[model samples]
Target: MADLFDNINDWLMQEALDENPLTSIVETFGRRLVEGGVPVARISIGRSILHPTIGLLDVQWEQDTGQVNTQAVPRQIVRNSLEIFDTPFGELSKGKTDRLFADLRDPDEVARFPMFEQLAARGMTYYAAFSRSFGRTHHLYERISNEFRGASLSFTTKRFSGFSQADLDGLERVLPAFCICLRMDIERFVAGEILETYLGKISGKQVLDGQVERGDGQEIDCAILYSDLRGSVTLSQTLDSTAYLDTVNAYFDCVATAIDEHGGEVLKFIGDGVLAIFPFDEANRPRANMCAAALSSAQEAFARAEHANRGRSGDGLPALHFGVGLHVGTVIYGNVGTARRLDFTATGPAVGLASRCEGMTRELDTPLVATGAFAEHCPRAGADLGQHRLRGFADPIALVSYPLT
Candidate 1:
């Protein structure tokens, strides 16, 4: 039995080195425990994860078909779930007990936890659980770190012989190693998620791929998009701080969601405006695709603004208005800034042209405007607005305005 445990430890360390997902590690460890002369029919592992999208994760393994199932739960859902406060798993997590063991054959013991009753119905004869630490802390688990964050594991057996003391001891001795391996996987996942959430996908990938130098970047041709909320300064004065912020969020959400849905990455939110891009690869993609995507995104933003305006008007608030600008050209899409703080974004004439087009929206009374470079690729009808001098341009800029649909 000790030799079997030694092999399991070696295999677990290798899994950690390979950087396996936490769910995969938990599933494989449970399967090995059952095969290592332990009468285990079911196993469950739960831990608090530091993630941008989720608060808790639980993994369950079943011996019947040798399958594993994993679940990620939001913090609100976990707090509202009654099982978190009543089940033996809950008790163990709370430190009320370091371990829990119950004979499912006993009706009184089965009544102690709702989960025990279910296990008994599933033909489980014995159940045991233990709590271990992941050696880390998270904000979501701050108040409940003693009851969560570490780790909680449970095992059940349906066999008449049930789990022996040695079986329990073996699992307890190996719990620390298992926790360490799982933490390695989680740390990698968290870093990736945080980077992707804060930085645009392409930039995030480049950084992770070792493009970390201060000036690391490349020039690329792409369609640039700029959206700005009209009359934002006036709105800020008319509404309270909370209402003003909510109004700004509503406008930005419309533009950002549209950009993301159409394969554009929003590089940054410049106050009430958004800067986004759709890269064009002439070798594989047609120029028309980038222009069309930008137009489609503009249309979506208009639709969402209309929807949001109706809601605001119903609540006695002012209606929202915004403008969109699209232009196509090459730009340096890479990191640039101070030595201490760098920003990964695009900077070139195309970016400036998009912003200039957006500025013309209010003057020309058009919600959507595109420069000649962008308009040439868009097949839709547009009213040609004659060349007009814009800020920072040496020559007059030709543009077209799309009618609101």
Candidate 2:
């Protein structure tokens, strides 16, 4: 048993060095333990994560199927529920216990947790849970206790005799090494989630691929979509801070959802405005496809706003309104900013033109406006609004109102 544990530890170290994915690591670890005569029937690992939408990441492996399954618990549920504290893993995580061991066959022990009852029903005889701290504080887990900064791992066995002293000892000895590998993979996963949450997916990948230098960027032709909430300044002055923020978020949800659904990436939110792009790909997606996608996204945004307005009006709140500008041109996409604080975004004359077109929304009294460059690729009929002088450009640019009304 001691030799088996030593071999497992060595294998974990190599897996950590290779940066193996957490799912694959957990699956293999469960199999190895079973093969080493530990008789582990099920293994579960749960970690608190930093993310906009997800609060907990759980990975479970079953010996029967030799497969691993992962689940992302929503932040809202994690914040609001007390169920997490009711389990054995929760006790270990809160530092109330160093480890847990229970015989599912014992009615008294099975009564301790609802999970034990289910495990017994599934033919699991014994259960054990242990926690490994990541050696750092997590804001989300602070309320649960600052000590719960890492992962909770649990193992169950279906053996009639349950886990013997040797099995428990071997598992305990190898756990630390396995957890070290898990931490490495979890940190990598968190970094990706955070970067993708703040920056668009494309930009996040670029940064991960080592596009860190300040001037590292490339000019790419794409369709730019700019959308801004109307009367935001007046709304800010009239509404309370919380109400104003809620309104802004609602508007953003509408715009961002539409853009994402139409294969566009929202780059940033400038106050009450959104900047997004649909990059043209010669192989899979062409320029016309990108332009059409941008146009469809703009129309979808307006539809979503209208739907939201119905609920707002029913509640006696003012209806929401916003404008979108669509254009296609080349822009530099990459890292830009001060030496220490950098932003991954798109910038160039094309971006400026898109913003200017959005500004024309107010003048033209239209919800959606497109530059001639964008209109050319869109098959949908649009009402030509002839040449109009924009703020930045020296010459007047032609604009069109989409949907032909």
Candidate 3:
């Protein structure tokens, strides 16, 4: 048993440096315990995570199938659920107990927790749960308590005699090392989630792939879509701060959702405006496909805003009005800004032109406008609004308007 634990510790140390995913680590650890004669039928590990959408991460490994399953509990669900307090893991996390052991075969002991009864019904005879702290807490810790403070590990067995003293002692001795490995992987995961949240998916991956230096970028041809909310200044002046923020978020949800669904990346939100792109890849995504996707996204954004406006009107709130512009051109996409504060985004004349096209929507009294470069790709031609000299550009550019149906 001592030698088995030593091997597990050595493997865990290497894994800490390798930073493999937490799921794979937990699955292998459970298998190792079973091979060492621990008779573990199931192992579950739960820990709080710092994510915009997810509050908790749960990983379960079952010896019967030698498979691991993972679940990401949403922040709202975790906040409202009282069921956590009824489990042994909940008791350990609350600091009411450091460890829990139950003889599942004993009716009285099985009745101690709802989980014990479930495990006994599944033919498990004994169960043990342990808590390990990562020694760090954040704002979420105040709301969820010890749940956000660290991790909880539970092991269940079908063995008639349950886990012996030696098995429990071995686990107690090895748990710290295992937790250290898990923390390493978790930190990496959190970093990625934050980056992806702040930066678009493509840009975030580039940063993670070691493209962190300022001015590190690549020139690429893509279709750019820019949309701005109309009368935002007046809305801001009339509405309170909270109400104005909610309104802006609602507008963003409409535009961003449409862009994402049409295979575009929302690069940034500049006040009331959104800048997004659908890259043109000759191998995977053709130029026409990207341009069409950008146009479709603009149409969908208008449709979503119209639906939202109907609800707002019923509630005696102002309707939402927005304009979208589409253009296709080459732009530099990558990191920019100060050494300390970098922003991953797209920049160039094409991006400027796309914004200008959106600005033209107000003058033309249209909801959607596209440059000739973008309109050329559409199967159905748009009504040409004639060549007009746009601001910042000396040459007159041809523009077209699409009918949002």
The residue pairs that clash in candidate 1, if any, are none
Q: How close is candidate 3 to the true structure, as a TM-score?
A: 0.96
Q: Which stretches of candidate 1 lie over 4 Å from their true place?
A: 51-53, 136-147, 281-287, 379-381
For model 1, residues 172-258, the per-residue Cα lDDT tens digits are 777777877868866776777777777877778888888777889999888899999889999999899999999898888889998
Candidate 1: 10-residue stretch with minimal lDDT: 138-147
lDDT per residue (tens digit) for residues 129-189 in model 2:
8877775786675446676777888889999999989888888887888888888987888
Best by lDDT: 2
What does the lDDT come to for candidate 3? 0.87
Q: What is the lDDT of residue 358 in candidate 3?
A: 94
* Local distance difference test, each candidate: 0.82, 0.88, 0.87
